[model samples]
Target: MHASSRRQTNCCRKPSTSGAKAPDLGNYAMSLTAALNTALMGLSTIQAQTGVTSGNIANAQNPNYTRKMVQLTTPAVGGDPMAAVVAAIVRAAAPNLLQDYYGATADYSRLSATTDQARQLAEALGIDDTGGGQTPLQSRLTSFEDAVKRLEATPEDTTLKALVVQRGQELAKEVNRLASQRTTLQSQTQDDIRTGLDTLGDATKAIAGLNAKIIGQKAAGMPTGDLEDLRDAEVAKIAGLVGVRTITAENGAMSIYTDAGVQLVGTTAQSFSYDSTTGTIRNTNGDNVTAGFSEGSLRASLDYLDGSAGALTSSDGNVGAMEKFFNQLNSMARNIADVVNAAYGSNLFNYTAGDAAATLAIDGAFTADPNTLDATRMGAVQQAMRNTTLTATQINPAGEPNGLSTANVNIFGLVSGVMAYHARQVSDNEAARDSAENLQANVEQKFRNLTGVNVDDELAQLTVLQNNYAALAQVMNAIREMFDEVISIGR
Candidate 1:
């Protein structure tokens, strides 16, 4: 009844050149076999389609899994096709959308690091942004000035003299504590970089190893969708640690590189190292990439060590929040010491000339005996506090400490400026971080819309495949019945 069977029957019915038409058992047998093979081809195609649909449904929740589909093909005996057969499996995804998502992820990580560090600094300095009280440094400065004024009014009060020394000790202790905090934060930053490098090394090695496996699987004509999934997940992980670009070859080997063109993975994986002494991150080639990092957690770490705005650094030739904070503290400490010591001449406060901030302390002579306090110098101390402004270069244990602007500010004003500088940093970096988070979310959603699996769609396809499989089975059974009737007729 089919076209191929009809064609065979019509050919078999043709008149013989010798004159009489004889029964052609061979042609009938071939027709039945041809019908059976056609049904088998349809059945095989249905099986492949079902498998692909099942895989899609199974991976519906997996973001990295790419959807797979069977490409249908047909075989022809002479001119027309017999039945459709699955040619090969292919994966579906938008490569450009995926790359954009990865880019956003890297940017978000960089800004988040910058913002979080600013908040950490604000907390450590006791400078509250949410209408909280003044920084301990600011309050201590006020208390010290008040004690000096009280002592100035009562030249012979031993209790007043002792109070001035007490307040001065508190103020000096606060400066030393803040300067020490910078050193502690520096050590912590180095440790974070070391941990990041370790994670980066592991990701690169895993990606490179996956690349080799993918190449082999693809060459063997196997479905490499799962392997590709693993590789993509690995890439996404390190994308936050450093900004990177990836290119996948036809053979399935993926090459990764920094956005700045530093090759991270080629035929083999690249390794990164962290130097605790210099607080620098280096690639396997020993290049100093700390200041060069444009977008990532590593970039944020560099900013934490310095600052982003018109921040002053110790000697690294870069400016950031921590750098500005450290330099400003040291400058203020030495300036205060120089003026107070010059005016009183009895060394009211003691500090090492090189590192004044870490060594600032109240003179033990005054604390030991309040009677030794020079009430005559109290007026000089007031004049020193009121008239003196930190407007010149000062000692820096690390490097040159650029003093306050030539605006002629008192000690309290200098301390206030440092707080204002950090507040601005927190505001700017937080805004940038919020913008990056929005961009990352938008890009990620776009990627998911384009390539993410749909369970309902796959389930519908599975239902259609089941119906088709049943139809093919019925067609094969009919062909078997026709073959039996012909065999009985031949006997």
Candidate 2:
């Protein structure tokens, strides 16, 4: 055969080792690259997960920090089957639990404010001092009664007359001091209302600003977990100041309103103005509207200062309980002065016409000369002290008798009744505060269980991430060695 014919025959002849497989270097390189990419992706996911777990562990003690979880999702990349990406970082917060916590906090704050004011009133009234065994007012009243009885037994004792006058002055002083304390409380409440308004304004504005930021971030496909958490915290704070309701829109915008349906924040924050002089809550448009606050520190202060719930006298259509208490004290002072002046034919006590409690004093004639306190009219004095038929018109111009029209009551009895009523109010408020605190604790615990970080759980998650990272690294090392082997073979 010719040389060309022999070469053709050799090319067409079958190989001796038919079982041996030939390596496809192009396909092997592609497969190795794809595998390396997939392993790198897995390592990246583990890194992200480890960062998240580390963050959780670091913020375990932070009350404001919510636990973060990274969600994994497989991408549509054609190269690798196991490659994944981070889809989102989720904050472990339950909206229902958050709302419940806000409500409980508001109730607790309201009760706390009310109880604090009541305790202050009790202290001022000298009724809460157990160390003295008896209140100063009670002691003075008892001493005056004793002196009057002794004067009745021995009408000739000028020294007993002086003692009776001294005791009467002491009783008047106590009443004046209590009334003054009430006035101070009213002033303090006014300051608190102003402070609350300022706080509300600041918080609402902050919420509105945050709403804008959140909306922007959501539109830009940015993570808003931290901003949302901050906004929620601010909302909770506002709820504690004034019971509020929140509405979240689809665009991540949030609106806030009072429980009474008064808008506080929306696209723009609404401004509030408080008129301490009129005890009115008004909007920026200058319209006076009822606050109608149910549970909050502001609501509690307003209730104690001017609310209609616990008034002693509902006359004249006025509702502030503290104001009514003060008015009742003034009326009692006026009644005592008028009756004593009528019985002794001398002005034993002097007081202003409208504000008798604030200005009650022992007359100079009675204080300087004990004889001016005549014991001859003991019967008339006793009758005046026990007078129950004293007309409301004589005591207060706007006051009308409460309960029975012809009922009989002494000065001490009427005053004690009002004091006891307020004391009961204080006790009830304290009980309510305690109940709310317990409920708050339970709700807080429930919330923490659902959203709080557990060290053991986090550690377990970290271990899993570590193992994944190690496995992915090994796969990467294998891919690198395979690439080197393929290069050596090519050389």
Candidate 3:
């Protein structure tokens, strides 16, 4: 062996040089490992991105859908120059615009509810106002007033008195029916609100469980973006039922709150329970309900119906516009009864007097009894009641043409005003609900843009990773060729 060979034989190792066969092969192995890792990471990115796009497309038809996005972070690897390491796939943080949308939802819901209640009341009162028969309450009032004027012409006519009694009964029946209908609608509204809250809470709990699953997988360096999109879809659905705000934590966990700032999920889930029968809503601890962060339409409806109706005040101390209406109706009924009684000496059409309002209620169903009294007197009384204006000038009593006393039927103004106001409110709410639906559509579109999966983007990336992986393999082949040449020379 020459000096270099002798030294090589004694050292029992290859020389350290860039072109050394063994060292070059080791370098090739390292390069291949790096390239392989890069390819794998690129593949994962493509898959995650694809899943997000798929989710967006799937929920396009859903009105309450919110979009989802995948988040990527780099991983630290030992000093390897060529490897690509992906730390985890995360869901996008919620947007600030959602807060604004939720607030609008709350307002619209309440307002719409009030509007709806009013509309229904108006419909019940037959206030289309197009034809004489269309506005039953108004027409009925006119008929009664006409009867009273006829009675003035023939106060002693028994047939006219009977007609007046019949007309009075008809008006009383209509008023009673309206009051009962309002009570039924209010009860139904309460039930709907309670049921909605229960559904919302159940959804929140499910999302919390999903959060745990997603974070656990992420910590293990797995692709959890697909599952994350499902969770987000569910959350968005829940959002439409109630307003929800979210907070992202350091460990890939999320905490949820209601628009009202009540926590739904964190260290533990704060859930709600609703009684369908009683129409009561409460928290997991069975406490009375609070709106919390729920910004959904259900809460909106409750606030609108309750607040607007409750705000209506009448001359009487009763609260709620609906109650005011009932009070006015009762007052009118009393006034009518007093007038009729003074003229005919009988309590024929009085709603129950104070403290015993229940008994004074006339049956909503009316039937005339012609045999009980003078028909002419009854007819005159009925006509006067219908035309009786709230103003004193409308009445003629005890030989006084303008005397306000002894005049009955002024309730026409109160009944018409209260019923009409309620109806207009309902119509307004219907319009508001339509507007809210449009807003919800716009919000969903925004969510889609942020979080939707684009298959084209993933496919493009896949092609790039494939080409790079092929290039790395080619480089390995070239390195092998050089090693083969070195081996041949030694041979």
- lDDT leader: 1
Candidate 1 residues lying further than 4 Å off, grouped into runs, are 1-26, 129-131, 285-293, 306-320, 338-346, 353-357, 379-406
What is candidate 1's lDDT per residue for 1-491, written digit by digit as tens?
69999899988895658876767877999988988999998998999899889988998888778888788888899796899988778787788888887889899998887777877777677876436667898888779878988888998898998898899899898988887887677778777777887888999999999999989988998878788888888898788878889988879899998777777889999888877666677888888766545668876786566433333533322236566666667766776777777878768888654432346888888888867878778888888877877553433333544323434677666777767766766788789889999999999887777677778888989999999999999999999998888888889
Question: Pairs clashing in candidate 2?
Answer: none
Each candidate structure's TM-score, on Cα atoms with residue i matched to residue i, is: 0.85, 0.87, 0.68
Candidate 3 lDDT score at position 66:
43
lDDT of 3 by residue, 1-491 (tens): 49989887879975668764343545655654565566566556655555555665576555444445455565546754433334444544346655555545555554555555555555666665545343676666667667666765776776766676566667666666655664576666667676666777677777788888878987788766556656665666566666677787866677877767767778667777655444345777887655463356565444433323223422211114344444445554555566555555455555564421222332233234544555445554654455545543233222211102323335566445545555555566677678876786676456555644445654565466566656656665665666566556555
Poorly placed runs, candidate 3 (over 4 Å):
1-80, 83-85, 92-94, 128-133, 149-160, 224-242, 273-281, 290-325, 335-348, 353-410, 453-491
RMSD in Å for model 2:
4.2
Q: Report the number of the highest-TM-score candidate.
A: 2
- lDDT of candidate 2 at residue 429, scale 0 to 100: 77
Task: State the lDDT at 298 in candidate 1.
Answer: 78
Q: What is the lDDT of residue 73 in candidate 2?
A: 91
lDDT of 2 by residue, 1-491 (tens): 69999999999998798788877888989989988877887888888889889999998998777888898898766553477888887789788888889889898988888788777766776667747356676676667667777888888999888988888899788778776775577888889888888888888889899999989988887767778878887887888888888889999999888788888897799778778766788877787654656568987777666643334344321235566557656766776777767776778789774432456788888788878777987667766677645543544444432222212456666556555655765788789899999999999889999998998999999998898888888888989999999988877
Worst 10 residues of 3 by lDDT: 397-406
